[model samples]
Target: MDRLHARYPFLDAARAAVDEADVDLAALVRSGGPAVDRGVGRVESAIETGDVGEPRRVRAELLSYPVARVVVSLVDDPRLTDAYARAEARTAHERFVDDVEGSTPVSLPEGIDLGRLLAEFELAAAVDVGVSVGVDEDRCTVDVGPYLRLASGLEGEEWRLVARDLDGGRVPVEREELYVLLREAVRERVLAGLPLSVPEPVAETLEPEVERVARSLSDYELPRSVTAELTPAAFPPCVEALIERARSGEELPDRSAFSLVAFLAGAGADPETTAAVTGLDPEAVAYRHERLAGENGADYPSPSCAVMQAYGDCVPVEKRDERCERVDHPLNYYATAVEEVSRSEP
Candidate 1:
């Protein structure tokens, strides 16, 4: 007990809190030696004055003693937020032990309070879960938390909540599906000794969607003109492609195919730059576009073109296109591209 205070002072208050508990909870010791009683008395006196220093010091001392930790952990029940108050008082001890056991040992200076650590974890959980968490005198709301979003296969949120709950000693067996996925993902990435950091449950939930979009872009090249505006996070496919190419010592499909197709569809590019970027003579790129247009015989209508058609503004540019009209031409081209791509698939 003395060793713990020297190492971690917050546990003093924790032990004090447990000792002062008037309730007949099994986690506390009803009576003990003068040493224990003195420790509790000192801590309780401090709590009455809002200082908690005496108890804080005692709690810190109790850290070296595992029996104290077990008792402290049991004070908070998972089902009720009211239990958070009890848990809060014990959290510093928990963190101190966890930190000591983890690869990173926490060495807190004197005067560091346990309440701060308790609030920090709760706030972090609230933010990471994208839920609104607030606690008042006796009411706490977790409505915006993971469980609220399960209607959309937002199992990721639920998974994260379960992990938090489990850590807090509140296990919800019904969330086994989420727990399994989280456990699998964690073990797969962590146990393999991978360099990647563990992703939050929110991020894991969106992993499939991100990967799906990325795979769609595996063969689909990005346009040079828009490359500056697009970032890896925004275009997960491009990022994945780049990463895979680097790992395999292979090149991804060039931007030329995409650029050429767009140009053929009437999205012209500057002559010099297109030639340089594609490694094709400027004339060749232009000729290919012309050839495609000639074969398709409709200049591969753009969305703007479709918009113009919809608005009956299908007048030829040579005849004078309007400057003020909105065109769905881009949408038409997009639809056509989708159709062409689908049909091209063998």
Candidate 2:
């Protein structure tokens, strides 16, 4: 648990939030009575109207009450506002980049002056530029920090500075766009708070009353132990494609890599098993597993298909056997497959 906390320091607050009994929504709402109802009504109205700024204000007001925080999450409704969901997910991605950049430092390749590159794009005057380059085996990747978009805007096109391998293909870069993206994430984290792993008795009591609001919480019910037995045949096409690429020593997009790791971890695969399946580094897989796990040892669900597609990881295939459209999250495929296998055995 200490190791898990050390690795995912961001989740410490979430762990604490879940453990506290005072966070129970029913109790809070019952105590607050009319005030809580009025607040919920206002937030719901803001959500229905798609008022961007209003939700933030509502979220702020609701933060004092743990139940109200979950109410805010439900009312904000990521499914209703896909743009909002994407933004939140993007923030998660940026945080991943920040973590990677802080831990792994890479030197820029010789003769590649970042200043000169910025000057070439007329972005030198706009912002301070810093470059962190990572090299794995023969592949080289470059991260131009958060200012790439600013630079791109100045250039008037989608201009990006990429590090190329000897063969001239794009490689991985740990881009920290935190400065630009952190505000919403911080707000969402505060508003939604962390999902607690409610015990079966507690969950049963709250489920009927807070069912809609509960769905807005992060996945908190995933088992600690590997319960679902997965087979290679049951692997989703997208996951299979990812595994094939990983095996061939290809770099995956950060979001895809994250989704794969989270999916494997949530589906009861141990770190070593996850690494073996995805061809990712064992240590990296282990860290990712721990990061996704909640205080009660349940793992979070994988990012949904929309997130995967937004990150360009969703490969469109012609005449696919499985209905990808039916699957929402990547883990859904695994979960469904496990159920199907179990039913067939009986």
Tell me each candidate's TM-score: 0.18, 0.42
Report every candidate's CA lDDT: 0.32, 0.46
Q: Which ten residues in a row have the lowest lDDT in candidate 2?
A: 150-159
Residue 70 lDDT, candidate 1, scale 0-100: 27
In candidate 1, which residue ranges exceed 4 Å CA deviation? 1-35, 55-60, 63-125, 128-346
Off by over 4 Å in 2: 1-208, 211-227, 248-258, 280-302, 317-323
Q: Cα lDDT for residue 106, model 1? A: 53
Candidate No. with top TM-score: 2
lDDT of 1 by residue, 267-337 (tens): 33344544443455467556544433322212222223333344343444454333213222333233334
Candidates' RMSD to native = 25.7, 14.7
Clash number by candidate, in order? 29, 0
lDDT per residue, candidate 2, 195-297, as tens digits?
4444454344434435543343323211122346557676667778778888888887666777777666666677888888888988877866665634212
